[model samples]
Target chain A: MDLQLIDQFAKNIIFEAGRRIRTAFTYDLVVETKSNANDLVTNIDRETELFLIEKIKSFDSTHKIIGEEGMGEKVDSLEGVVWIIDPIDGTMNFVKQHRHFMISIGIFVDGIGKLGYIFDVMREDLFYAIEGVGAWYNDSPLRKLQPVKIEEAVIGINASWVAPNRHIHHEKVIELVRKVRGTRSYGSAAMEIAFVVSGKLDAYVSMRLSPWDIGGGTIIAKEVGAIATNLRGEGFDFFHQDTFIIANPSIHQELLEKYIVQYD
Target chain B: MDLQLIDQFAKNIIFEAGRRIRTAFTYDLVVETKSNANDLVTNIDRETELFLIEKIKSFDSTHKIIGEEGMGEKVDSLEGVVWIIDPIDGTMNFVKQHRHFMISIGIFVDGIGKLGYIFDVMREDLFYAIEGVGAWYNDSPLRKLQPVKIEEAVIGINASWVAPNRHIHHEKVIELVRKVRGTRSYGSAAMEIAFVVSGKLDAYVSMRLSPWDIGGGTIIAKEVGAIATNLRGEGFDFFHQDTFIIANPSIHQELLEKYIVQYD
Candidate 1:
């Protein structure tokens, strides 16, 4: 497979999606609640997803797509070429702040991760990876992530994960928050993961995230020698929602063992 | 006082300081640990502060200055025309990420906030206010902030406030975190307050912050109908470090009464 070509194609599609998103922001958005009030879906999100799916289909009809807005095919397994798309990863941020949101696309072949692209629509920062070739932030190639001790690390984690919530023990997470150099919550999974890859943030932890949320970021982070896993320190499932902990290789295990507590 | 002219003058100084900061990022930095390992100060921070102080002193010799880097006069009170300066608000962010840090300058007349300026140096976005004339984000005028309920508000709060630490009760803060729509920690009080003023964030709560951190933001937020007070719902002390809660008027009292637990 021509990974470079595929990467370029993905970047073009993402940039196009970003343009559409930018245009949509100027006009009044027709927003609707999805699942819950906090889980919002704007007209722009659907439109961007449809546009991406159409581009993907025209590029390769045989490729399967799993999109956040349900505009693509429902694949049972990653058998052939699979594309995971999150039109707007931080839909709430998009609707509320009109910034900090992203369009993420992850491409896989026969269950093997290949190319990925994450575009910060407003910032116009394009983060992409071509399997083994390496990840690039805009025009420059990203360096491998450096190891960081827990005390010296700045982790990206929302307060939700550390509060008395259903997913993890709030107290243990609090301990982790205290131990780290600092904590930041941008309310966007893909962007936070991109920060980790770019060395802006040392780690990102969340109690629940969808495959589309982590798909693109996972590939980009892996290219820079970062690790992505569930709270249990296991590999992510490409078809289900799971807790995510993407961090530098040096502290990933330590964070999981010390902070992340999963109740069976 | 000519608030508008002072606003413009402050803006120019901030922009110039921003330019210096940007140029400094290109060269190797001389970083020194301050109070602790996490408390950092860079040569750039001190240099930027000195530059701003020179400009302020030259612009108006009669003006009193209070600066984070200790470059300005040590005024015992907010008398006369006072200028509170944080040359680089998010010093750690500047040292680590090279973005998100800002230059914040707050001007006052006889202890009353008269004008303010906060510039995101790397992004080149300026957020400033001219007393009665209202706040401007870049060249665009900012609208008055709309009210948001606790359940629908995105609050800017660091994880330290909710963890087992000094200042506030961790349990109550955790409850507030659970109830709010979401929480974000950007690690810069000025930027967070700017977010609150711009309606990107509904409120910002910090257990400890100095005058330089909140001075400029207070002026801007107040113009947007947001309220700035201590966690105890009292006014801020311009001469000392204190807990702060800057928020929309509608939710300010409620958040203070319910969430912010001041440990006597």
Candidate 2:
């Protein structure tokens, strides 16, 4: 496969989708609840997902597509060329703030990620990576990440983990929060991962996230020498919803071993 | 005091300072530890403070100034015209991320807030307000903030408040975190308050902050009908560091009554 060709095509589609999302922001949006009250879905999310699916299929009919808004195929296996799409990764942010959300798309071949793209729709920042080639933030190439101690690290984590919750021990997460230089929760998994890649955030930890949420960003982060794994310090399954901890290589293991304790 | 003239002068100075800050981002920053390792100060911070002081002095030499970088007078009273300046509100973020920091200036006349300005240095978003006039985001006038429920609100709070800390009860804050729809920590008190005024964030609570940190933002927030008070639900003293919770009026009283527990 021509990786460069695929990368260019992905960028074109993401930019076009971003343009539509920006236009939609000008009008009053119609939002509805999803699984829970906090989980919101807007008309723009569905429209953007459909737009991506149509463009992907038009580009290559044989390509299998999986989308968050249920506008694409529901394939059980990661077989052949597959496109994982999260039209608006932080739908809540899009519906509420109209900023900080992203359009993420990951192209995989037989379960191996090849090309990835995450566009900050409002900020016009395009983060993309080609496996074995490199990662780029817009037109500039990203440098290898430098190691940072946990004390000096600025992490991205939601307050949900630190509160009394069923997912993990709140105390341990709170301990970690105190130890870090600072903590941020942008409400966008894709943007958080992009922050790790851009060196804005040293790490990002979340109890549960869908494959589409971290799919594209994982590739870009890895290209910059960052590590992505489940909270158990195990490799992530791109096909399953699981706890995720993506961080700089120096502190990823330390955070997992010393801080994270799942409430199984 | 002519607040409109002062407001215009403050805007011009902030814009000039922001331009200088943007240029400084290209060069390597000189960071120094202040009070603690995590508490940082940079050369740009001092330089920016100096610039603002010069401008303020040129405009009105008799105007008292209290600044974060210690470039201003140590006035015992908020008499006559006083300009409270935080040259770089999020110093750690400025030294590290180079984006999330802001330039905050609050102009008060005889202990009464007359005008306020918070300039997002990198994003170039200037949020300003004039006493008895109205608040503005750049050129657009901000509308009165609509009330949001605790269950539907997005609050800006640092994780330190929910940890085992000396200022407040961790358990109560943890409970509040779970009840809120979402929580964000932007690492910049001024930006957080700006979020409250802009309706992006419904509230912001901080355990301990200096007058310079929340001074400008407090004016803008109040102009938009939001409330700014100490954690005890009392008025803020702009001369001392104190625990603060600035929020939309609907949830402000409830958060203080139910969540905040002073360690005394």
Q: What tens-digit string does per-residue lDDT give for candidate 1 at B88-176?
A: 99988988888888889898899888888888898899898888889889989999987788899999988888777778887888889
Docking class of 2: medium
Error (Å) of candidate 1 at residue A167 is: 2.4
lDDT of 1 by residue, A156-257 (tens): 988877777788887888899888899999989999998999989999988889999999999898899999999888889777898999999999988888
Residue-wise C-alpha lDDT for candidate 2, range B1-264, written one tens digit per residue: 677788878988999999999998889888889899988999999999999999999999999999998977787788999899999988877877778899998988999988989999989999999978899999999999987899999999887777878888888988888888898988999999998999999999888889999889888887899999988778787878988888898988888878877777
Model 2 per-residue lDDT at B154: 91
Error of 2 at A125 (Å): 0.9
**In model 2, which runs have C-alpha deviations exceeding 4 angstroms?**
none
Residue B34 of model 2 has an lDDT of 85
Residue range A73-167, candidate 2, lDDT tens digits: 78787889899999998887787777889999988898888888889998899988998889999999998999899999999998778877898
